[model samples]
Target: MFDIVKQWKWYDWAMLLLRMVACISLILTFIELRDQFTLALWVVVLWELAAFSVPWLCLLLNHKAYWVTETVISGGISIYLTSIFPAAYLSFIVPAFLMAANSSGIAYRWTGPVTIVLIPLLIKLYAPSTNLILMMVHVALAFAFGFAFHLLMVNHRQNEIIRTQNTVLEQYLSQVERVTLLEERERLSKELHDTMGHTYTAVIMGLESLRSTAADAAAQHKLSDLLELTRTSLDEIRGYLHELDSPQEQLPLVQSLRQAAEEFGRNAGVKVGLRVLGDEYQISRQAKMTFYRCLQESLTNSVRHGHATRMDVLLQFELQQTRLEIQDNGRGTARIQEGFGLSAMKERASRLQGQVSIHSDSEEGTVVTCSLPRALKPADDVIKLMLVDNEPFVRDSLGMILESERDFEVVGRAEHGLDAVNMCEELQPHLILMDLEMPVMDGITATQSIKQRWPSIKVVILTTFEQKGKAVQAMRSGADGYLLKTMEPRELAEHIRIVIRGGTLMDPSISAKLFEGDASDFLEEKTVIAPLDTSAPESSPLRVLYDLTPREMEILQHLSKGMRYKSIAMKLYLSDGTVRNYASALYAKMGVRNREEAIEAANKAGLI
Candidate 1:
């Protein structure tokens, strides 16, 4: 529909012009006849009729295409008729409607020029016996009228173009903004899934395994092991939550300020020039993250709104407060209006009892300055270093990292094999984050040796792998905690604290892996059996799954039948509540949840 209009709309305006001219010609033809011979007038009228009728017929067929030709023919007919037969003007019927239809707007801009030429012909025919001043007066007015209509049309077109351009630009920006928001959301979800979600699953699996087992040597051992894992995980979770809430870190103002500037550089399209001047004293983590976030907001505003290509960060850590300024050369309108992000930045600064000022302009770009008062802090404590990797780069990097931290003394170091063993024995600091893979003295070995010799000391196994087997081995070997190597320095610091405090740690993914396969034979493994033709695969803990009391077996059968918790509860004539307890026991004993897992376990073990 729109395509058709685009192709044919011009003819509409042309058709209107033609109709106006036809009407004018009809009037002039009649007027010319009024004063003179009816025969000449009749001839002019016939000409007008031919000119008007033919185009209108053409318009009726495809008015949009031939309207220009129609209008030109009609206008030409009107002008010629008036010029050739002046008596036609006496009728004056067409001028009234033509004037109204064309007006002085866009449609009439050309009409004025046409009128100038046509009126002259009409006046010449009618006023061949009149004064010369009257003709001059009429001619001058016609030219002036034509120019007025032309100006109106020009202004209207300019306005229309401006509006269309503005609409297109707005739509483009909106689409871009929507895409960016979706991308950011996707990134956040992936981060949560990859990091925190996996950790939680591992920890849950270890716990559930412990909870599901009967009180035997293996069950007791798994319970003790899982309890330890959960504690360390709790500490890490606390620290993560701490990061979420307070987000404060123990770092000097200068280091974190530089980090803020670098963050902007990383996220921004252009290079962000960060210059640090003066000594940066240690500040609280809350203050550091706040300053970092504030800097981030400023950079986002500069890059996203101001369109900055370069940004600058200047800092002066005085005796009291830290003064930092970030400036960008970008585009901004002349206004003091603040966007939502800027308002949030202001709120954070206010919470810190800090002051922030922002300035922006279309030409001058944007600047954000902030000054935060340092917290009344505690004195430094002893620095404890724990390296968990056998890689030289990793251990050395960690050692160098610790050594670089003021007051962080690398009291102990470990390489491959018994070097760690020797280190553990001699320089037994407050804690040791042992790695899983070492040459002769792997993290497991080092942990076992350390625990045996110095049971009072703590150890956290740091490694890249989080397999179920490895995790269970480390826990059984008396390792105090486990952490991914990808943790930030702040996270590592918190892990050390929780380890010293007798907390357990485990990522959640490990839990999902635990309930993955049959664990009946988990206590006594290493069996090689041929495949059995069954619908479901086999499960371990074969004895426990089968040795249910007859009534319990009946309940298990009901469970395997996909019965709801409540329905199963009522089926055995026992109280629904006791049946619920029986179901919980079923889940633990079977090492499964929901009907499918129970069915698989029962079918594999031949109990159902």
Candidate 2:
């Protein structure tokens, strides 16, 4: 009740004040007419009281019935007051009738017009001496003013709603930008740690070896100085890495939660209590980060929207799962319209195979519960890889580099594509790095064969060539990733990890080449077409003249080139479902029933 009052606008206060004045005036009028009070006069007083009090009762209960009931009662009171003292009480009754006509919540559409017409007629009927024409003019004026005021209030409400939507959109966009920037930062930090850290370690090892081989004191002293400087530089890089870490990564999940709660309490002047239950266990970095972000978002919502004064946080570690609950003593809402904050919280939790649930009420406040699984993959589970290349030096170098990383194990090495395929049945590696040009069988055919036989196995084409056509063909053959031999060894390992995590990777230069041209130009270059058949039907030219969008034309070209829907979707950066929808629409437009018919139509029209 207090929350509703707090949300009232200025006009609400003004209307309330006007209602108060009308009630006071009616009370004084009754007191003055007590000596001449009749049954009609007593009835008028009771009706006025009921009419005024009903609106308040309806508002508190949030009843939809208030609109019709209030309109009827207000109309009745207006007629009674006017009939009792036509000229004397015109001011009070006019406002009452207008208020009913301009009510924001009028369930019955006919109520406003009925109130307008009936009140003037009653005035003329009760006071026969009153001028009918003048009263009719007054009714018209009252309706005009009432309708204008209603429109103004409607416009104001719509503007408020738009403003609120804009605010939410802005917040969501800002959060996306921040998330993108953070991800880029994390990537750079990792790249630096992997590449530069290894390089530094290699340099230190070389300097020590050289120093031991030195026979002169001067050379030894200089080498020692250089070694000291290199060590200091490595220490500085470590410091920068620490600074680049996100706040959530700086401490354990529990300590981070406590610190965040304490800091928020101190700044927002809200009381926050945190409790832990059961023995804590180690969680993945991603899960820890998700938990931290959810807590921060919940705290912001409780204070910003719920206007909470006190919050209670509970962390429980179960045998199979970890749970976090947040409760707030705030003015909770009956309906929860999830805005960006709540939606983002859910998204974060879901990414880590977790779930978030919220329950809210006007009296009991809001409770948010987030649960994540405790059974996460161990850190030492290495990715079993198979190296495939005809060149011995290439295979050996890649094997040496990958073996240096604890997370990668080269389970098998093959000299060619056919050998790799034969080895896969025995090795059953998690990932196979294959070269494009190999003896007996090429990489693309090998990849397609392996994928057809064992779809679970991932294949990445690692080659020296940067040809766009080869990359497209490799992807069409179900290659998980494509990269050049020029990529840093550490970066290659990271890319392998990415592929293992169900993400696709492409060399940036090749990606640019694949997506460079406009739709028509790209289709013309990538799609092959046979010379126009002079022997075919002449009506085919008419079929080719049918109107088609650039996207539809592009899709048709792809279909004619023997590319599957999944391959088209990957090339176009669209979902499989979206590609299917486009194909359906294209079929409808082109008067075709399926992919085969569409391709035949395009070929006859010389579109491919």
Of the candidates shown, which would achieve the greatest TM-score relative to the real structure? Answer: 2
lDDT of 2 by residue, 380-429 (tens): 45678999999886887777567656467999999888998999999988
Displacement of the residue 59 alpha carbon in candidate 2, Å: 5.3
Assess the local accuracy of residue 508 in candidate 1 as a C-alpha lDDT between 0 and 100.
54
Count of steric clashes across candidates, in order: 38, 0
Which portions of model 2 miss their true places by more than 4 Å?
1-3, 35-37, 40-42, 59-64, 88-102, 105-109, 139-152, 155-159, 162-170, 202-229, 247-288, 296-322, 326-368, 371-608
Backbone clashes in candidate 1 total 38
Kindly report which residue pairs in candidate 2 clash with one another.
none
Model 1: lDDT of residue 43: 68
Candidate RMSDs in Å, in order, are 23.4, 14.2
The lDDT of model 1 is 0.58
